[model samples]
Target chain A: MIDVLYFAWLRERIGAPKEAVESQAATVADLVEELKSHSEAHALAFSDMTSVRVAVDQELTDMSAPIKGAREVAFFPPMTGG
Target chain B: MGVRVQSAPFDMGAEVQAFTKAATGAGAIVTFSGVVRDEGGTLASMEIEHYPGMTEKALEAIRQDAMARWSLTDALVIHRFGPLKPGEQIMMVATASRHRADAFQAAEFLMDYLKSRAPFWKKERGADGASWVAAKDADEDALKRW
Candidate 1:
Protein backbone atom coordinates (compact mmCIF):
# COMPACT_ATOMS: atom_id res chain seq x y z
CA MET A 1 0.00 0.00 0.00
CA ILE A 2 1.23 3.47 -0.92
CA ASP A 3 -0.08 6.64 0.59
CA VAL A 4 -0.99 9.02 -2.23
CA LEU A 5 -1.34 12.63 -1.22
CA TYR A 6 -2.75 15.60 -3.09
CA PHE A 7 -2.24 19.22 -2.19
CA ALA A 8 -3.79 22.60 -2.90
CA TRP A 9 -6.03 22.53 -5.91
CA LEU A 10 -5.19 18.94 -6.55
CA ARG A 11 -6.60 18.09 -3.15
CA GLU A 12 -9.69 20.16 -3.77
CA ARG A 13 -10.26 18.75 -7.21
CA ILE A 14 -9.57 15.19 -6.19
CA GLY A 15 -11.74 15.72 -3.10
CA ALA A 16 -9.30 14.27 -0.58
CA PRO A 17 -5.94 15.03 0.93
CA LYS A 18 -4.66 11.49 0.96
CA GLU A 19 -5.61 7.92 0.22
CA ALA A 20 -4.16 4.43 0.24
CA VAL A 21 -3.54 2.72 -3.04
CA GLU A 22 -2.42 -0.81 -3.62
CA SER A 23 -0.41 -0.86 -6.80
CA GLN A 24 2.53 -2.57 -8.47
CA ALA A 25 3.70 0.37 -10.52
CA ALA A 26 7.42 0.56 -11.08
CA THR A 27 7.92 4.32 -11.42
CA VAL A 28 6.17 7.49 -10.45
CA ALA A 29 4.92 7.87 -13.99
CA ASP A 30 3.45 4.41 -13.90
CA LEU A 31 1.82 5.21 -10.63
CA VAL A 32 0.40 8.38 -12.14
CA GLU A 33 -0.93 6.48 -15.12
CA GLU A 34 -2.61 4.08 -12.74
CA LEU A 35 -4.02 6.94 -10.69
CA LYS A 36 -5.23 8.82 -13.75
CA SER A 37 -7.49 5.88 -14.65
CA HIS A 38 -9.03 5.69 -11.21
CA SER A 39 -11.76 8.23 -11.75
CA GLU A 40 -12.81 11.38 -13.54
CA ALA A 41 -11.49 13.48 -10.71
CA HIS A 42 -8.14 11.72 -10.98
CA ALA A 43 -8.14 12.16 -14.73
CA LEU A 44 -8.88 15.86 -14.45
CA ALA A 45 -6.33 16.52 -11.74
CA PHE A 46 -3.60 14.66 -13.60
CA SER A 47 -4.63 15.94 -17.01
CA ASP A 48 -1.95 18.57 -17.47
CA MET A 49 1.38 17.02 -16.71
CA THR A 50 3.23 20.28 -17.11
CA SER A 51 1.41 21.89 -14.21
CA VAL A 52 1.78 18.96 -11.86
CA ARG A 53 4.77 18.18 -9.70
CA VAL A 54 5.57 14.93 -7.97
CA ALA A 55 7.51 13.90 -4.90
CA VAL A 56 8.29 10.37 -3.84
CA ASP A 57 8.67 9.68 -0.17
CA GLN A 58 8.73 13.46 0.43
CA GLU A 59 11.71 14.18 -1.81
CA LEU A 60 11.25 16.43 -4.83
CA THR A 61 11.86 14.44 -7.99
CA ASP A 62 10.83 13.93 -11.57
CA MET A 63 8.15 11.80 -13.19
CA SER A 64 10.69 9.07 -13.98
CA ALA A 65 11.57 8.65 -10.33
CA PRO A 66 11.38 5.09 -9.04
CA ILE A 67 8.88 4.27 -6.33
CA LYS A 68 9.78 0.67 -5.73
CA GLY A 69 9.93 0.83 -1.96
CA ALA A 70 8.42 4.22 -1.42
CA ARG A 71 5.82 4.60 1.24
CA GLU A 72 4.24 7.83 0.00
CA VAL A 73 3.74 9.87 -3.14
CA ALA A 74 2.42 13.40 -3.46
CA PHE A 75 0.97 15.24 -6.40
CA PHE A 76 0.55 18.99 -6.42
CA PRO A 77 1.00 22.14 -8.41
CA PRO A 78 4.31 23.93 -8.26
CA MET A 79 4.90 25.46 -4.86
CA THR A 80 4.22 29.17 -4.29
CA GLY A 81 5.77 29.58 -0.86
CA GLY A 82 8.45 32.13 -0.07
CA MET B 1 20.19 25.29 12.22
CA GLY B 2 16.50 25.26 13.15
CA VAL B 3 13.22 24.85 11.30
CA ARG B 4 9.63 25.33 12.38
CA VAL B 5 6.41 24.48 10.59
CA GLN B 6 3.35 25.67 12.45
CA SER B 7 -0.09 27.27 12.14
CA ALA B 8 0.45 29.81 14.88
CA PRO B 9 1.55 33.35 14.20
CA PHE B 10 5.14 34.21 15.06
CA ASP B 11 6.79 37.41 16.22
CA MET B 12 9.57 38.49 13.91
CA GLY B 13 11.19 40.62 16.55
CA ALA B 14 11.31 37.88 19.14
CA GLU B 15 12.43 35.34 16.58
CA VAL B 16 15.29 37.53 15.47
CA GLN B 17 16.24 38.22 19.08
CA ALA B 18 16.31 34.52 19.91
CA PHE B 19 18.28 33.65 16.80
CA THR B 20 20.79 36.38 17.44
CA LYS B 21 21.26 35.18 20.98
CA ALA B 22 22.08 31.70 19.76
CA ALA B 23 24.38 32.88 17.01
CA THR B 24 27.76 33.71 18.51
CA GLY B 25 30.56 35.56 16.72
CA ALA B 26 28.41 36.55 13.80
CA GLY B 27 29.43 39.73 12.04
CA ALA B 28 26.25 39.94 9.98
CA ILE B 29 22.67 38.87 10.36
CA VAL B 30 19.96 39.05 7.69
CA THR B 31 16.30 38.12 7.81
CA PHE B 32 13.47 38.09 5.32
CA SER B 33 9.78 37.96 6.17
CA GLY B 34 7.02 37.20 3.67
CA VAL B 35 3.58 38.67 4.28
CA VAL B 36 0.18 37.93 2.83
CA ARG B 37 -0.52 40.65 0.30
CA ASP B 38 -4.12 41.52 -0.43
CA GLU B 39 -3.73 43.47 -3.59
CA GLY B 40 -6.56 45.98 -4.13
CA GLY B 41 -8.29 44.69 -1.01
CA THR B 42 -9.65 41.75 -2.92
CA LEU B 43 -7.97 38.98 -1.07
CA ALA B 44 -9.93 37.76 1.93
CA SER B 45 -7.32 35.31 3.16
CA MET B 46 -4.70 32.85 2.00
CA GLU B 47 -4.78 29.21 3.00
CA ILE B 48 -1.33 27.61 3.14
CA GLU B 49 -1.19 23.86 2.98
CA HIS B 50 1.96 21.88 3.54
CA TYR B 51 3.01 18.25 3.76
CA PRO B 52 3.54 17.85 7.46
CA GLY B 53 6.57 15.55 7.55
CA MET B 54 8.11 16.72 4.30
CA THR B 55 7.86 20.38 5.20
CA GLU B 56 10.28 20.03 8.06
CA LYS B 57 12.61 17.83 6.04
CA ALA B 58 12.71 20.22 3.11
CA LEU B 59 13.23 23.26 5.33
CA GLU B 60 16.01 21.54 7.20
CA ALA B 61 17.69 20.43 4.01
CA ILE B 62 17.63 23.97 2.68
CA ARG B 63 18.95 25.33 5.94
CA GLN B 64 21.74 22.77 5.93
CA ASP B 65 22.60 23.59 2.36
CA ALA B 66 23.01 27.24 3.27
CA MET B 67 25.09 26.32 6.28
CA ALA B 68 27.29 24.12 4.14
CA ARG B 69 27.77 26.58 1.28
CA TRP B 70 28.38 29.66 3.37
CA SER B 71 30.33 30.70 6.40
CA LEU B 72 27.09 30.95 8.32
CA THR B 73 27.31 30.77 12.09
CA ASP B 74 23.65 29.86 12.30
CA ALA B 75 20.53 29.63 10.21
CA LEU B 76 16.79 29.43 10.87
CA VAL B 77 13.60 28.97 8.90
CA ILE B 78 10.00 29.36 10.06
CA HIS B 79 6.97 28.71 7.84
CA ARG B 80 3.33 28.89 8.84
CA PHE B 81 0.41 26.82 7.57
CA GLY B 82 -3.40 27.32 7.69
CA PRO B 83 -5.43 30.43 6.94
CA LEU B 84 -3.79 33.83 7.21
CA LYS B 85 -5.31 37.27 6.94
CA PRO B 86 -3.98 40.06 4.80
CA GLY B 87 -0.86 41.77 6.13
CA GLU B 88 -0.01 38.84 8.37
CA GLN B 89 3.45 37.38 8.19
CA ILE B 90 3.51 34.09 6.38
CA MET B 91 7.05 32.96 6.93
CA MET B 92 10.61 34.11 7.64
CA VAL B 93 14.19 33.01 6.97
CA ALA B 94 17.29 34.16 8.80
CA THR B 95 21.00 33.71 8.20
CA ALA B 96 24.09 34.76 10.16
CA SER B 97 27.56 34.90 8.76
CA ARG B 98 30.95 36.57 9.22
CA HIS B 99 30.34 38.99 6.36
CA ARG B 100 27.51 40.87 4.81
CA ALA B 101 27.91 39.22 1.45
CA ASP B 102 27.47 35.70 2.79
CA ALA B 103 24.58 36.74 4.98
CA PHE B 104 22.86 38.56 2.17
CA GLN B 105 23.47 35.90 -0.45
CA ALA B 106 22.37 33.07 1.79
CA ALA B 107 19.19 34.88 2.72
CA GLU B 108 18.29 35.38 -0.94
CA PHE B 109 19.19 31.81 -1.80
CA LEU B 110 17.03 30.56 1.04
CA MET B 111 14.12 32.63 -0.18
CA ASP B 112 14.52 31.40 -3.73
CA TYR B 113 14.63 27.75 -2.75
CA LEU B 114 11.77 28.16 -0.31
CA LYS B 115 9.66 29.55 -3.11
CA SER B 116 9.71 26.57 -5.44
CA ARG B 117 11.43 23.66 -3.72
CA ALA B 118 9.34 23.59 -0.58
CA PRO B 119 6.10 21.64 -0.39
CA PHE B 120 3.91 24.52 0.73
CA TRP B 121 1.08 25.55 -1.59
CA LYS B 122 -0.95 28.74 -1.33
CA LYS B 123 -4.60 29.35 -2.21
CA GLU B 124 -5.77 32.94 -2.22
CA ARG B 125 -9.41 33.72 -1.54
CA GLY B 126 -10.56 37.06 -2.76
CA ALA B 127 -13.86 38.90 -3.13
CA ASP B 128 -15.10 36.69 -5.93
CA GLY B 129 -13.59 33.33 -5.11
CA ALA B 130 -10.40 31.43 -4.34
CA SER B 131 -7.65 30.09 -6.50
CA TRP B 132 -4.34 28.36 -6.04
CA VAL B 133 -1.38 30.59 -6.65
CA ALA B 134 0.65 29.27 -9.55
CA ALA B 135 4.40 29.09 -9.48
CA LYS B 136 5.94 31.87 -11.47
CA ASP B 137 8.33 31.14 -14.31
CA ALA B 138 10.69 33.71 -12.92
CA ASP B 139 10.92 31.77 -9.68
CA GLU B 140 12.28 28.71 -11.48
CA ASP B 141 14.62 30.85 -13.54
CA ALA B 142 15.92 32.57 -10.45
CA LEU B 143 17.30 29.26 -9.12
CA LYS B 144 19.76 28.94 -11.99
CA ARG B 145 21.82 31.86 -10.72
CA TRP B 146 22.76 29.99 -7.57
Candidate 2:
Protein backbone atom coordinates (compact mmCIF):
# COMPACT_ATOMS: atom_id res chain seq x y z
CA MET A 1 0.00 0.00 0.00
CA ILE A 2 1.15 3.51 -0.79
CA ASP A 3 -0.02 6.83 0.60
CA VAL A 4 -1.58 9.22 -1.91
CA LEU A 5 -1.93 12.86 -0.99
CA TYR A 6 -3.71 15.80 -2.61
CA PHE A 7 -3.35 19.49 -2.04
CA ALA A 8 -5.11 22.79 -2.78
CA TRP A 9 -7.94 22.49 -5.29
CA LEU A 10 -6.99 18.91 -5.92
CA ARG A 11 -7.64 18.19 -2.25
CA GLU A 12 -11.07 19.81 -2.46
CA ARG A 13 -11.86 18.01 -5.67
CA ILE A 14 -10.62 14.67 -4.43
CA GLY A 15 -12.57 15.26 -1.13
CA ALA A 16 -9.84 13.62 0.92
CA PRO A 17 -6.36 14.91 1.67
CA LYS A 18 -4.80 11.48 1.79
CA GLU A 19 -5.56 7.83 1.17
CA ALA A 20 -3.93 4.44 1.05
CA VAL A 21 -4.27 2.16 -1.93
CA GLU A 22 -2.73 -1.07 -3.02
CA SER A 23 -1.70 -1.06 -6.65
CA GLN A 24 0.69 -2.74 -9.02
CA ALA A 25 1.51 0.53 -10.79
CA ALA A 26 5.19 0.93 -11.53
CA THR A 27 5.39 4.59 -12.44
CA VAL A 28 3.79 7.73 -11.15
CA ALA A 29 1.88 8.10 -14.41
CA ASP A 30 0.56 4.60 -14.10
CA LEU A 31 -0.49 5.23 -10.55
CA VAL A 32 -2.28 8.37 -11.65
CA GLU A 33 -4.15 6.38 -14.25
CA GLU A 34 -5.22 3.87 -11.63
CA LEU A 35 -6.36 6.67 -9.32
CA LYS A 36 -8.38 8.31 -12.07
CA SER A 37 -10.45 5.19 -12.40
CA HIS A 38 -11.53 5.16 -8.76
CA SER A 39 -14.12 7.95 -8.88
CA GLU A 40 -15.40 10.92 -10.83
CA ALA A 41 -13.84 13.25 -8.31
CA HIS A 42 -10.43 11.69 -8.79
CA ALA A 43 -11.00 11.76 -12.50
CA LEU A 44 -11.82 15.45 -12.40
CA ALA A 45 -8.82 16.36 -10.26
CA PHE A 46 -6.44 14.43 -12.46
CA SER A 47 -8.12 14.98 -15.82
CA ASP A 48 -5.23 17.03 -17.14
CA MET A 49 -1.87 15.69 -16.13
CA THR A 50 -0.14 18.88 -17.14
CA SER A 51 -2.08 20.83 -14.54
CA VAL A 52 -0.74 18.68 -11.77
CA ARG A 53 2.71 18.09 -10.31
CA VAL A 54 3.78 14.96 -8.53
CA ALA A 55 6.26 14.22 -5.80
CA VAL A 56 7.30 10.70 -4.97
CA ASP A 57 8.77 9.92 -1.57
CA GLN A 58 8.79 13.64 -0.73
CA GLU A 59 10.93 14.63 -3.70
CA LEU A 60 9.71 16.45 -6.79
CA THR A 61 9.81 14.11 -9.75
CA ASP A 62 8.29 13.57 -13.15
CA MET A 63 5.29 11.33 -13.67
CA SER A 64 7.48 9.07 -15.78
CA ALA A 65 9.66 8.39 -12.75
CA PRO A 66 9.47 4.91 -11.29
CA ILE A 67 7.55 4.50 -8.05
CA LYS A 68 8.21 0.89 -7.24
CA GLY A 69 8.94 1.31 -3.55
CA ALA A 70 7.78 4.83 -2.87
CA ARG A 71 5.76 4.99 0.31
CA GLU A 72 4.19 8.39 -0.43
CA VAL A 73 2.93 10.19 -3.52
CA ALA A 74 1.63 13.74 -3.57
CA PHE A 75 -0.36 15.53 -6.25
CA PHE A 76 -0.85 19.27 -6.47
CA PRO A 77 -0.85 22.17 -8.85
CA PRO A 78 2.38 23.95 -9.66
CA MET A 79 3.73 25.65 -6.57
CA THR A 80 3.22 29.41 -6.00
CA GLY A 81 5.31 29.66 -2.87
CA GLY A 82 7.62 32.43 -1.55
CA MET B 1 21.10 26.59 9.69
CA GLY B 2 17.60 27.70 10.50
CA VAL B 3 14.56 26.45 8.58
CA ARG B 4 11.08 26.77 9.98
CA VAL B 5 7.62 26.15 8.57
CA GLN B 6 4.91 27.35 10.89
CA SER B 7 1.43 28.91 10.86
CA ALA B 8 2.10 31.52 13.52
CA PRO B 9 3.01 35.07 12.61
CA PHE B 10 6.65 36.05 13.09
CA ASP B 11 8.23 39.37 13.85
CA MET B 12 10.52 40.11 10.91
CA GLY B 13 12.54 42.65 12.85
CA ALA B 14 13.27 40.23 15.62
CA GLU B 15 13.96 37.44 13.19
CA VAL B 16 16.50 39.50 11.31
CA GLN B 17 18.15 40.54 14.54
CA ALA B 18 18.31 37.01 15.80
CA PHE B 19 19.63 35.63 12.52
CA THR B 20 22.31 38.27 12.34
CA LYS B 21 23.39 37.59 15.86
CA ALA B 22 23.62 33.89 15.20
CA ALA B 23 25.57 34.40 12.02
CA THR B 24 28.60 35.46 14.13
CA GLY B 25 31.43 36.19 11.69
CA ALA B 26 29.32 37.34 8.72
CA GLY B 27 30.04 40.82 7.44
CA ALA B 28 26.95 41.00 5.22
CA ILE B 29 23.42 40.02 6.13
CA VAL B 30 20.54 40.06 3.70
CA THR B 31 16.94 39.49 4.71
CA PHE B 32 13.89 39.45 2.49
CA SER B 33 10.26 39.22 3.56
CA GLY B 34 7.31 38.54 1.28
CA VAL B 35 3.99 40.13 2.15
CA VAL B 36 0.50 39.25 1.06
CA ARG B 37 -0.56 41.55 -1.74
CA ASP B 38 -4.10 42.78 -2.22
CA GLU B 39 -4.31 44.38 -5.61
CA GLY B 40 -6.64 47.39 -5.70
CA GLY B 41 -8.41 46.21 -2.55
CA THR B 42 -9.80 43.25 -4.35
CA LEU B 43 -8.28 40.62 -2.09
CA ALA B 44 -9.70 40.07 1.36
CA SER B 45 -7.16 37.51 2.43
CA MET B 46 -4.78 34.82 1.25
CA GLU B 47 -4.65 31.26 2.53
CA ILE B 48 -1.40 29.34 2.22
CA GLU B 49 -1.43 25.58 2.23
CA HIS B 50 1.62 23.34 2.40
CA TYR B 51 2.70 19.74 2.72
CA PRO B 52 3.73 19.57 6.37
CA GLY B 53 6.47 16.97 6.21
CA MET B 54 7.98 18.06 2.90
CA THR B 55 8.03 21.79 3.56
CA GLU B 56 10.81 21.75 6.13
CA LYS B 57 12.86 19.28 4.14
CA ALA B 58 12.64 21.36 0.99
CA LEU B 59 13.63 24.52 2.82
CA GLU B 60 16.53 22.79 4.53
CA ALA B 61 17.74 21.37 1.25
CA ILE B 62 17.60 24.78 -0.37
CA ARG B 63 19.43 26.30 2.58
CA GLN B 64 22.12 23.66 2.31
CA ASP B 65 22.44 24.27 -1.41
CA ALA B 66 22.89 27.98 -0.76
CA MET B 67 25.54 27.29 1.85
CA ALA B 68 27.42 25.03 -0.54
CA ARG B 69 27.35 27.49 -3.42
CA TRP B 70 28.43 30.51 -1.46
CA SER B 71 30.86 31.52 1.23
CA LEU B 72 28.12 32.04 3.77
CA THR B 73 28.14 31.67 7.50
CA ASP B 74 24.45 31.07 8.06
CA ALA B 75 21.00 31.01 6.43
CA LEU B 76 17.41 31.04 7.59
CA VAL B 77 14.05 30.49 5.93
CA ILE B 78 10.74 30.86 7.72
CA HIS B 79 7.51 30.35 5.83
CA ARG B 80 4.05 30.56 7.32
CA PHE B 81 1.02 28.60 6.19
CA GLY B 82 -2.53 29.78 6.92
CA PRO B 83 -4.79 32.73 6.25
CA LEU B 84 -3.09 36.08 6.14
CA LYS B 85 -4.29 39.61 5.55
CA PRO B 86 -2.95 42.11 3.05
CA GLY B 87 0.36 43.68 4.05
CA GLU B 88 1.00 40.88 6.51
CA GLN B 89 4.26 39.06 6.22
CA ILE B 90 3.95 35.70 4.55
CA MET B 91 7.54 34.48 4.70
CA MET B 92 11.14 35.53 5.10
CA VAL B 93 14.60 34.41 3.89
CA ALA B 94 17.81 35.58 5.42
CA THR B 95 21.38 34.91 4.30
CA ALA B 96 24.72 35.89 5.76
CA SER B 97 28.10 35.92 4.07
CA ARG B 98 31.48 37.58 4.24
CA HIS B 99 30.61 39.82 1.32
CA ARG B 100 27.47 41.58 0.18
CA ALA B 101 27.47 40.06 -3.30
CA ASP B 102 27.43 36.49 -2.07
CA ALA B 103 24.70 37.23 0.41
CA PHE B 104 22.57 39.03 -2.17
CA GLN B 105 22.93 36.38 -4.88
CA ALA B 106 22.29 33.50 -2.48
CA ALA B 107 19.19 35.20 -1.14
CA GLU B 108 17.89 35.74 -4.68
CA PHE B 109 18.64 32.15 -5.63
CA LEU B 110 16.81 30.94 -2.52
CA MET B 111 13.82 33.11 -3.39
CA ASP B 112 13.74 31.88 -6.96
CA TYR B 113 13.80 28.25 -5.88
CA LEU B 114 11.20 28.84 -3.21
CA LYS B 115 8.79 30.34 -5.72
CA SER B 116 8.51 27.21 -7.83
CA ARG B 117 10.23 24.35 -6.03
CA ALA B 118 8.65 24.67 -2.58
CA PRO B 119 5.49 22.76 -1.67
CA PHE B 120 3.30 25.72 -0.77
CA TRP B 121 0.08 26.73 -2.46
CA LYS B 122 -1.69 30.07 -2.24
CA LYS B 123 -5.41 30.77 -2.42
CA GLU B 124 -6.74 34.26 -2.75
CA ARG B 125 -10.08 35.37 -1.31
CA GLY B 126 -11.62 38.32 -3.02
CA ALA B 127 -14.95 39.97 -3.75
CA ASP B 128 -15.88 37.37 -6.32
CA GLY B 129 -14.90 34.38 -4.21
CA ALA B 130 -11.94 32.31 -3.16
CA SER B 131 -9.67 30.82 -5.80
CA TRP B 132 -6.33 29.08 -5.89
CA VAL B 133 -3.59 31.28 -7.24
CA ALA B 134 -2.40 30.05 -10.58
CA ALA B 135 1.26 29.25 -11.00
CA LYS B 136 3.07 31.75 -13.16
CA ASP B 137 5.28 30.71 -16.04
CA ALA B 138 7.57 33.52 -15.08
CA ASP B 139 8.31 31.80 -11.82
CA GLU B 140 9.47 28.68 -13.58
CA ASP B 141 11.59 30.71 -15.95
CA ALA B 142 13.20 32.49 -13.01
CA LEU B 143 14.61 29.19 -11.75
CA LYS B 144 16.53 28.66 -14.97
CA ARG B 145 18.83 31.53 -14.06
CA TRP B 146 20.33 29.69 -11.11
Retained true contacts (fraction), each candidate: 0.90, 0.94
lDDT by residue (B26-99, candidate 2, tens digit) is 99999999999879899999999999989888889999999999999999999999999999999999999989
Question: Residue B143 in model 1: shift from native, Å?
Answer: 0.3
The digit string of per-residue lDDT tens for model 1 on B5-76 reads: 999999999999999988899989999999999798989999999999999999999989989988999999
Those runs of model 1 whose alpha carbons end farther than 4 Å from true positions after fitting are none
lDDT of each: 0.93, 0.94
TM-score of each: 0.98, 0.98
Best by lDDT: 2
In model 2, pairs of residues that clash are none
Model 2 chain B lDDT-worst window of ten: B16-25
DockQ leader = 2
TM-score of chain B of each: 0.98, 0.98
The DockQ-derived docking category for candidate 2 is high
